[model samples]
Target: MSIVDALDRVCRRLDEIRACVRWAEAIVREGGSDAERRASNEIRAASFIAACGAMEQFFRAFVEWLCGEIGQSGLRYVEIRLSLHSIASSGDFRSLQSLRERDPMFGRRMDLLNRTVSTKSCSLKVPRDELGLGGETIRPGQVSNVWAVFGLPGSGFEDLGQEVAMRVLADSRNDYAHGRVDISTFLAHPECEPSRFLDRISALEEWCFHCWSAGLEYLDSQGYRR
Candidate 1:
């Protein structure tokens, strides 16, 4: 396949993964029998987790191929790709440097994965989900490290876990590698104030819809539909 074709495929996959994540979020929101709810949650979470794995593979491979095509050195190419993409998405060029300062291990892996995934001898190991983010199959990978950045109320990665700036950014292993927007504001939106947790789940659903739409578009462009 042409490079464009490969990119098109990857984009479509990424979109699907995003939709799956959102789907899991939505299913978990609907009130139902305990068993039913658990089943739904498991399905959604499994789908999303699979999608995230595919995305990690896509990013690693895409960056490596692009780097090889452009003749960029392998050293830290993952970081460079992420930095550029992050800049495009977040409008913060400094986030790359800032993230670097935050954790050097992830920074380095990002760099290596970007360059390694395309080589004949290289492989991008998608991280597993030990956090029970979903069901059992969300095996960990180097990207698993980003979950630390997600920061819960008290611990893991971020030292100051205030709700004021609750970070909703995507983990490197997430389907949305560019990172998600701040969930705090969306969850707290007036429409969601009554049931904050449910609202957050709704936001996740919206995220899934966005991913689905984008993926469908990409697939349509490729003369495929689902």
Candidate 2:
């Protein structure tokens, strides 16, 4: 999908999370009983988890879309950054090496050498995992790693003033998912209030928008090509 389309999907997902927050807010305003309060807290925690999921989905979709665009840009392998080429070739290179070692045949070794050379002249097609995004949470560092692969500075989000929000969203999600924090404990944080959570989520939405814009700019400027 296009970056704009990917971004729109995430924003819509966040909107749904915001609706959940509103539901929790209504419970709080009703002077909920202890059990009801607990339910509200759990709802907030679930909202946080869903928010993090939205961000992660966006990151993965954006990266895949960006890579697809790069591949279709008619940029030769040699024209892109060496880091990208290396990342794109890493899996193939490892597979070739493994095959050569298993067989210990001259032909296998020669095939490995030929594939390595051919990679330099072929069109660039980066593997998804080349960005080190192996199903981990979408934290600031992970976001930076993806940008860096496209020749952008890894600190792009930090520079754009969205790092803390991104980090909090990821860390909080992990805490809830891994049972590191209970619902009560998770809700105790100032940012965990339904309203405050929405604010943080808004910041995250801003970050995604910036990423989409920057990605389009990068492609338009031919930054992916030398």
Tell me, by TM-score, which candidate is best.
2
Model 2 lDDT per residue over 49-71, tens place: 88888887788788877778888
Q: How much lDDT does candidate 1 score?
A: 0.36
- Pairs that clash in candidate 1: 127-140, 127-141, 128-139, 128-140, 128-141, 129-138
Candidate 2 whole-model C-alpha lDDT, 0 to 1: 0.74
Q: How many backbone clashes can be found in candidate 2?
A: 0
Candidate 2 TM-score, C-alpha based? 0.83
Give the whole-model CA lDDT for all candidates, comma-separated. Answer: 0.36, 0.74
Q: What's each prediction's clash count?
A: 6, 0
Window of ten residues with lowest summed lDDT in model 1:
149-158
Error of 2 at 23 (Å): 1.7
lDDT of 2 at 197: 81
Mark the regions of model 1 whose C-alpha exceeds 4 Å error after superposition: 18-30, 70-226
lDDT of 1 by residue, 79-185 (tens): 23332222122313234445545566466556544443333321222222322332222222322332232111222222222111112222312422224523433
- What TM-score do all the candidates reach, one by one? 0.29, 0.83
| Candidate 2 Cα misplacement greater than 4 A, ranges | 33-35, 93-134, 153-155, 158-161
